[model samples]
Target: MSKAYVFTRNGGPEVEALVDRDMPTPGPGELLVAVRAAGVNPVDWKLRKGYTRPGSVPQPFPTVFGSEAAGVVEAIGPGVGGFAIGDEVFGNPVAGGYAEHTLLPVAVTAHKPAGISFADAAVLPVAAATAYDGVRQLGLAPGATLLVTGAGGGVGSAAVQLAQHAGVRVIGVASASKKAFVESLGAVHVEPGGGLADRVRALAPGGIDAVFDLAGGDTLREAALLLADPAALISAGDKQLVAELGGAPVERARTAAVLVAVAGLVVAGALRTHVTGTYPLSAAGEALRAVEDGHALGKTVIEVTV
Candidate 1:
């Protein structure tokens, strides 16, 4: 039997529990991973509250609560090639990542580099990859200024760093508490909420070349106004709002190639996971709570020992 932290039904934290279950078996093109670490994100709790990704079938009850993980391949399913048992790897999970074991589809999985730790690799598939795609989609040139809302959070923080690494000047909008944190990523920090655009204007009078929005709704709206061409705007947070504003959602290239690229960036010191918190699998709930509470400084991971 394997232990997993799961939600029995769609609801709040009340529905979540740590339970024992049979070991999972990987199907064709999948690998059963002995999870060493699982990254926590807002989507975990959002899914527990019944938010489904577009076109993704909902997992049945007692569903696991994570999106990405890193571990050794315990077993490889039929038809899967280029991987062997005991190889270290990380990727988006087939089930959920918050478990002793879970399945990872080969299409999204990548071999873990020696330089990256399990905690850092666990977050690359989601947070770092999203940042990678959004920054590339904007195609901002060096010396161009990019505005990143919610810059203190996982994706936001990664975006800020990646953009700066590309020689783009980044103005990060986050809570006052994360000012130092955002600035540490080399972004000019701007507080969020009312008057966001004006403050950003004050920071980059020449104007914002693009907006990579991780904070949606009004924050996205305000940032959109900073761009002379709405086509320069892209969002990972509020897709609908961005579309209505004449901008597009971040075009996610969810492939092993993209994962490899982001992992390489981490290895080269061009990107940092900025993992701020880690919990054992037994304390998965607290890890989820930290992200769901909307104040987690960076990535949170659940480290599983087996």
Candidate 2:
């Protein structure tokens, strides 16, 4: 039997309880993976707490809660291609990632790179996808300046690295404690308090070429005020704020397309994945709490296997 974390009712992290179940079989166009590591994101908690809308699948009691993970493919469905048993892969499993095994759609799973460990690759699908969408939306050119708020968090950190790789100057807004960490990712760090727009102006003087608002509270509003001419901005957190700023909502399809492109980049060694912490599958609740508590410096993952 495979072990999985499931939420029988919408509530806190405590609602996530582990249960033993039979391993799932892959459908046509699916791959069954023996999960090694599962990436934990804010959305996981959001869904669990009913902060975000539930998916189309009816939430039967004991529904699995995780999505992204890295593992070795134990079996591949008849119609699938480009993968085989024993292949190392990473993907967003639509249902239960916090498990010993899970099934993923063939399109979502990608061959894990030789240089990337399962723990690191597990951090890719959700946070990397969000960061990729932000960068892609801006079409940020070399020498351009990009500002990212909440740079200490997973998606924000990924944005900083991806933007820097594109030859754009990156300015990251984080708390004082996270300044050095953000700087290590090749971004100039700014403290979160004060007139953020004014501080950004003091640094860039000419305004930012693009902005990525991962912290969607007041930071997004500040980003709108500091945009350069013909501004481009992407908000990963709040759709209402995007609409309020007259910015386009970052759609899931666009995010997925960006992730596919970035996955190629990761495979090519053009980008790096940052994993801050790993927990045992039994400690999945603690991992989610770390993400919810907003203290994690990078992606937090649950290690389901050695």
The global C-alpha lDDT for each of the candidates, from Candidate 1 onward, is: 0.93, 0.82
Q: Encode model 1's per-residue lDDT on 1-306: one tens digit a residue.
A: 999999999999999999999999999999999999999998899899988899999788889889899999999999999999999999999989999999999999999999999999999999999999999999888999989998999999999989999999999998999989998988889998889889888888899899999889989998999988999999999989999999999999999999999999999999999999999999889999899999899899999987
TM-score of each: 0.99, 0.92
Misplaced by over 4 Å in model 1 are: none
- Candidate 2: regions farther than 4 A off: 53-58, 228-231, 253-264, 267-269
Candidate 1 shows a clash count of: 0
Candidate 2 lDDT by residue in tens digits, 260-306:
57777777766777787889999888888898998988889999864
Root mean square deviation (Cα) for candidate 1 = 0.7
What's the lDDT for residue 262 in model 1? 96
Report the error of model 2 at residue 38, Å.
0.7
The RMSD of every model to the true structure, in order and in angstroms, is: 0.7, 2.2
lDDT of 1 at 138: 90
| Top candidate by TM-score | 1
